[model samples]
Target: MTAPFRPLPFLSEARAEQAAGPRLRALRQAAQRAREAFTSEGAATALATCDLVSFPYPTVFAFSGAARSPAPYVMVRHRMQVVRFQQEGTERVLLFNPSDYERGHEAPFFKALREKYGTFVTTQVMTRRHGTVQAHLEALGLTPEDVDYLAFDHLKAQDIRRWLGGDGQPAYFPRARLLVQRAEWDAVRCPHPLERVWYVPEGTGGVPPERVELLSGDTWLGQGVALLSTPGHSPGNMSLAVATADEVFVMSENGVATESYTPLQSAIPGVRTFAEQMGWEVVLNGNTRENSLEQYSSMIVEKVFAGRARADGGFVNVHPSSLLTRAVMAPGLAPTITLPPPMSGAFTPVAAPRHAA
Candidate 1:
C-alpha cells in the first residue's frame, strides 16, 4: 500500500547537512560552493516544483534505427539525470533511467553491452566518470529515506531490484515506493527478443509487493507532474512531464538529445535533407529495427511534451541530461540544454491532468 504523503519542513542547504555525518557532511562543503550556481531565476514563477541534478554518463549509440542514414552513430553527453519533484513542501525523486554510475549499482544491461560492444561502451559508456545519485543527494543532505516516489519513463536496461531491496536485504531508500507502469513491469519479467538483453534477471523478484505502485495509463503524479505512456522503444515505455513557471520539461530516452527530437532542425549535416527525402517521420532512440514503428510514434508524443515547456510558444528540448557529448547536430540548430526555469515563490501549478497533444 502507498503511504500518505507527508510534507517536511524545507531544509536549507546548511541545515540539511547538519544531520549528515562527518564523512557525509564533507560532501556538502563542495556542494555548498556549487549551490551558488543554482538560481531561482528571480520573480519568475516556475511551472512545477522541479530540480535537475546531472552527471556524466557517456554512451556511443546511433541516434535512430534509420539504416543508410547520415550521422548514423555518435557519442552522447550528459546521459544520467536525477529529477526531483516537490509539492506543498513534499518531494519525490524521479530517476530517469538511473543505471551505470561507475561505482553505484550495476545492471545486466551494462554488463551485456560491454561484453558485446567492447571498450567504447565498457570504458566510456558504463564506466564514465560521474557522481552517483547517492553521492549527490548526500551533498544536499538527503538520503533515500527522504524520497517518497521513484519512477522511470520505461524499464529498458533498468536493474531496479537493488534500488528496492527486500527479503532481508537492505534497500537503498527504505521508505520510498517505486512507481512503474504495469506494462513495463510485465515486459521486464518476459521481455521481447530485442529488449531481452536489457532486463536484469529477477530484477523485481525481491521487491516486496507493497513497495510497488502500478499504473495503467497516463496519470498525474502531483500538481504539475505526470507520467505519460509513450510506448515505442518498449511495450511499456513512458515519459515524464513537469510544468514549471518558466517552461515544462521532460526526461526520457525517446530522443537521445535535441537533434533526435527535431531532425529537421538537426545540425548534423545532410540529416535534414536526407530525412526529408526519405519521408522519415521520426527517429528511434535505439538502433534495433524491432519495434521501429512504435519508436517512431513515441517520438511524436515526446515532441508534444517538449513543446509544453513554454505557453507563449517555446519548445521543450532535452539537455542531453547527464550525458555530455561533443557531437552537436549543428551549431546553429543545437538547442541549449538546461533545467526548467527557476522559481521565486509559488510554482505555476497545473490544475489537473491536461490532454496529451
Candidate 2:
C-alpha cells in the first residue's frame, strides 16, 4: 500500500545538502524497485502526450540568468500526459496538467501580456491553441467520465471550477478527483503578491471540496507511478515519475528544457559559459526566485530521479511540462535539444466496469 502524503520540510542551503544524499539514495532504490515491478507485473500499459497551446514567455525566465539571447520572449507549448496502468486487476487513467485553454486567459500574467502587447498581437498572432483536452480524449476513444484523476505540477493558470463543478455548475469530468498538494491548495486560495501574477483570479473558488484530494507530501499512486513533492517554484510543486520499459521519465515544470539540467553541455551560446562561471550544475526556470535555494534542491532531486537520458548521456530525462518550442514568432530562442514523449505503447481505452444489477 502507498503511504499517505505528509508535508515536506523547508530546506535551507545546509539542510538541503544534508538531505540530498539520503534522498537521492532512497529515490534511486525506489525507482529500481518500480522498474522491476513494471517488468514483472506489466503494471503500466501506455503513456501518450497531448499538445495543447503555445504562447510567448519571457526569455529571462526560461534559463534564469544563463541565457544571453537578444530576443525578449521564447515560444512555449504546454502539453498533457495521459498514463494508463492497472492496480489490483483494475485499470486506471491519470491526466497530468490538462489545462483549460479558454479559462486560462484570466491569469494575471496573460492579462499583463495583453495590456503590453495589444489584444490582437497577444491573442491572434502570438498564442496558438492546438486542440482541446476534450478533443484529445475523443481521439483516444475516452470520455470526461472515464478519467480517474487530474493533477498539476502546480496550479498557475488553472481553474478547477469547470472540471470539478462549482457554484452550481456541472462538472466536465464528473468522477475524477483532483490530486493537489495541501500547501498548493492554500497557496492558490491565498496567493502572496509574488504569486498573484501567475494565477487566475478566483480560480479555485466555489469548486466542490470533495472533488479535491489534498496530499501532504510525496505519494505513490501505484506500482509504476508516483507523485514526488518538489517545492520552490510554488509552495507545493510536485513532479510525476513513471517507470517504463526503456527508462524512468520524470515530468514537471521544474526546468524549461533538458539543457536546463545539463547547462555545461548546452549548445545555446551563453549557457555553458554561465554554468562554468557560476559553478552551477543546473539552470533554473527562474519565473519565481524568492525560494531559490529550495527550488534548486528540488530540481536536483528531479535530476537524480530522472537519471541520464539514453539518447544523450549528457542530459537527464527531465521533460518540461511546458516545453520551449521553435517558432518564427519567437526568433533566436529554440532549445538545443528536445525529448518527445519517451514512454512507449499506445493507449487502449478500457471499458467501464459493469455494476451488479
Candidate 3:
C-alpha cells in the first residue's frame, strides 16, 4: 500500500547549490556554497505544509516470455509529472500523460508468448482490447461520453506511434500539447499541417497558458528550473534542472535510475530496442537483457526530490531537510548532508493481474 501524500519541506542547501551543472567540479562548488548559505540563513525549526496536486495517468506493466512465444515483454510507460511550477500563485502539475486508468495484468500474456515464440523477441505489447475502445469512439468523430477515456487512448497511442516511427495520423489534444525539443520537432513531420505545435527552444520561457514550454537551459520559474536534453537514454528524454537558494537538483524522469548506482544508460536498451529497433549501450548489468526497473527507480528518486522542493519553500527547504540540516541547526559542526528517503510511491510499478489467451 502506498502512503498518503505528505507535503515535504525544502532542502536549504539546494538554494545555494542551484548552479551545479552536470560536471563534477560544478557539483562540488555548488555543495560548498550550499554549506555556507545554511550557516548564514539560520534554519527554520518546523516543516511547512502545502497542498499536493497530481494528474491522473495510466500505469504500465511488462512481462517476459519464452523464445517461441510472442516476444520478451519488457518496460511499461505511465503518466508522470515532468515539470511543476506555479501559475498565478497556484501550483500546477504538468503531466507527461493525463488519461483514464485501466487495470490489466500482463503475466498470463507473457506465459502464452513464451509458449509460442520459443525465444521471444524483446518487445512491449498492449492488449488489443486497450486500443479498441479508443478506436471505436474516435471513428465516430463525436466526442465520447467519457472524455478521459478518449484522452487516455490518444496519449497512449501517440507514445506508441512515436516509438514505432509509424506514419499513422498524428494524435492531437486541444487541452494539452507536446512540449518537445527543437531538434525533435525538426525530425517530425506534422501529420496535421494546420494543427498548432509549440516548440520549446533550449532553455528560457515563461510558463505560457495552453502552450507547453520547450526549454534548453537552466532557467527558474516560481519554484523550479528547466534543464534541456541530456540524451543517452532517449533522443527526446529531457529533464528539468533546478536549484534554490541552498541546494541544487535535477529531475531527469525516466532518463536515469533512482538508485545511486544505476544510470539511465542501463535501462535504455530494452525499451529503445522494443520501441525503435535501435541498439543502445546498457550500462547496468553488461548483458543486453531487457529490464527497466532500475531506470524507473532512478527517475522516481529525482521526482521525489523535486516534489519535496516544491512542497517546502522551494530549494531553501531542501538543505535544512536534507544534508545541511545539522549545519543549519548547529553552525560550527562539520557540514554533513544526508539525503532523505525519496518521496514515497513516486514510481510504483503497475502490476498486470492476468491476460486472456
Candidate 4:
C-alpha cells in the first residue's frame, strides 16, 4: 500500500478564523511548531521557473481588496515551476502550473471576453506566448517523461486535454499524474453560474481518470515541499510551498504580487490606504467571492509558512504563480517591488530505475 500525504498542522487556522481570538492563537502556536519541524527536515534538491505567457489582467481582480486604481489592467506573467526532490531515495519531479498558453482561448470566458471587448478593453494583450512547456523542460535537461506529477494552483482558464491525453488524444507528459483538490476537480467539471466564466467548457472531459490524483486537504509531498489548501479564490484552491537553501517560497494565484502579501508596506497608489482602512494584512486575488474570508486566512498561512525574504525582511516570500509584471500595454500599474525568479541548486535528468537480471 502507498503511504498517504502527511497533513500540516497549520490547517486548523482555516477553521479557527470564525472566532479568531484566543483559540486562533493557540492553533497558530501549534501550527508554527509544526512549520518549524517541517522546515528542519531540509530543503529540496533543485527548483527552477519558466515563464510561459504575459498578458493584461484586470486591476480589479489583481487587487480585489484594494480595488481603487486608475489603471484598469495590470500586465501579468504566468510561469511554470519545476521542482526536483528525493522521495524514498528516488528523484521525483513536480511541475506546478504548467499552463498551455496557445490553447488558452478554449476557455469560454476568455473566448467571449476577447470577442466582445477585445478592441476597447484588451486588444492584442489578452495572451502572449513566451515559450512552450516542452521547450523549457528540454532546456533544463528534463523530458516530459521525467515529470512524475502535474498540478495547478487552481483550474481557472486551464485546458488539460493536451497534457493528460483527453478526448482521444495522446498525452504531452506521458508519466505525469495531475494532483488536484477534489473540490477543485468537481467545481471545474460543473461550475456554478458565477464560477463558469473562469473555467474552460468541458475542460476535464475525457481526462483518463487514472491519471488524476485527488487530494482532500493540505499535503506534505516530501523533504521541503508541501501543497497548502488555500480555498477562497476558488473552491479547492491550493498553494505550492517549496523549501530551498535560501528560504521557502509559496506559489499561488491567491495574490498577484509581493505587495499582495505585504499590503501595509505597499507603495501602489491605493493598496496601502485600502489595507490600512480595512485592517487587512493581505490583499486577495478576488476573482471569486464565495470564500473570501477563508482565502484571507489561507494567505495568512502562506505568509507565515513562507516567512520573510532572507535578503530583505520587508516582504514575505509568497510568489504568485502568475506574477504581476510591468507591461507597456498596461501603464500606471507597476509592482512597487519585484523579485527575480526564485532558483536553487541545479537541474539534472532523473536516472532510470534499475532492472534485475
Number of the predicted model whose TM-score against the real structure is largest: 4
Writing each residue's lDDT as its tens digit, candidate 2 over 181-222 gives 899999999999999999889888899887888886666676
Residue 64 deviation, candidate 2, in Å?
0.7
Q: Is candidate 1 or candidate 4 better by lDDT?
A: 4
C-alpha lDDT of residue 194 in model 2:
96
Residue 167 displacement (Å), model 3: 12
Highest-lDDT candidate: 4
Error of 1 at 6 (Å): 18
In TM-score terms, candidate 1 sits at 0.67
Segments in model 4 whose C-alpha atoms lie over 4 Å from true places: 1-4, 10-27, 65-67, 117-126, 354-357
Looking at candidate 2, the ten consecutive residues that score lowest on lDDT are: 5-14
The parts of candidate 2 lying over 4 Å away from their true place are 1-43, 354-357
Winner on lDDT between 1 and 2 is: 2
- Evaluated against the true structure, the overall lDDT of model 2 is 0.79
TM-score of each: 0.67, 0.89, 0.33, 0.92
Ranking by lDDT: 4, 2, 1, 3
Q: Which stretches of candidate 1 lie over 4 Å from their true place?
A: 1-61, 65-73, 78-93, 100-109, 116-121, 124-126, 308-315, 318-324, 327-357
